[model samples]
Target: MAVQTYSGSCHCGNVRFEADIDLAEGSGKCNCSICSKTRNWSVSVKPEGFRLLSDEQATTDYQFNTQSVHWPFCRTCGVRAYGHGDIPEVGGKFVSISVACLDDVTPEQKAALAVRYADGGNNNWWNEPSDAEKQYL
Candidate 1:
């Protein structure tokens, strides 16, 4: 996959960023509670390729449950821009970008991307496949 430049920002435009990422594929959508509620569709990216163009203070963090991840949103408009996953040994890591936050990318561009379904709410996501699971998984 070739590397391509993509730009995105939070709702109020306080947090803007540009990423040189391999957009050859779409990312997975999790059926977890938080994801379902927000309808968070995303794509994967290497931690290094993703950059923070604005000051970190421009966003506020929202965490819950085990508190393993940080969902950073624009403090002004309350739009979730990105997130950090807590992996053991690696600590917190940025693994994906919210598709809704990205710009100039169309649904067709996203359709060509790969999709993975995460069982975040249920730890045993690997074991079960519900009827609706066929679409994204």
Candidate 2:
């Protein structure tokens, strides 16, 4: 599938970004604590594939588990607009951009891409859950 550029922002528009993604490739939904709680619908891209247009101070970071991921949320509205993490298999770093925040995509448009559900809750039914993190699109 061809890569396309898309724009997005936080609920209060405090955090904004642009991402180059191939929507046909789909995104991810994990039943992990943070994911399920936040209703995150996200897709991954390399650092270069994403650009944060807002001031870095507009967002706050929250992390758990192995603390490998830096989940960023809008300080004003508490919206988790995006996240950064590492996937050694693909690259040294990656960004998990929220499909829900895509300005041009409707719920249907976002849903059009096949979503792969990870059993994060079950896979992480322990203190250490890194071994269960997903490694896919």
Candidate 3:
């Protein structure tokens, strides 16, 4: 798939960034507490594929629980721009960018992309290999 460029920013326009990602692989929605509360529909990409065009000082970090993930939000607008997940097995990092913040992407194009639902809230159930596991694991 061709690499596509996407531009996005915070609601108050204090933070802005661009990313080169594969839209064909599409996006995902995690049923975890934070994600569910924020309604954050996102897509994961390698750390190197994303670029922050503005001042990094304008961003604030929010972390909870195990704190393995870093949630970066705009300080001025309180909008989550992206998040980082550690993946030691792959020797890489997973970055989840908010799809709602992405600009210039047509609604049709967004709808056409595949949406994978992750059962993060019921993470332990993923090991059971049941029908629900097959649906969102």
Clashes of each: 4, 0, 0
What's the CA error at residue 100 for candidate 1, in Å?
Answer: 1.0
Which scores better on TM-score, 2 or 3? 3
TM-score of each: 0.82, 0.83, 0.85
Please list the residue runs of candidate 2 whose C-alpha ends up more than 4 Å from where it truly belongs after superposition. 89-91, 124-137
How high is the CA lDDT of each candidate model? Answer: 0.76, 0.82, 0.81
Predicted structure with the largest TM-score when compared to the true one = 3
lDDT of 2 by residue, 1-137 (tens): 68989999999999999999988888887778888787777898889999999999998888888898999889999888899998575468999988889898777777588877766677643232343454421
Superposed Cα RMSD, model 2: 5.4
Off by over 4 Å in 1: 89-92, 127-129, 133-137
lDDT of 2 at 85: 90
User: How big is the RMSD of model 3?
Assistant: 3.5
lDDT of 1 by residue, 69-124 (tens): 78888989988878878565434465567888898777888778776667755765
Off by over 4 Å in 3: 89-91, 124-137
Better of 1 and 2 by lDDT: 2
Summarize candidate 3's per-residue lDDT along 1-137 as a digit string, tens digits. 67889998989888898988898988877667788688778888888888989898899988999998899899998999788878575356888899889897789878887877766777741333345533543
Clashing residue pairs, backbone N/CA/C < 3 A, model 2: none
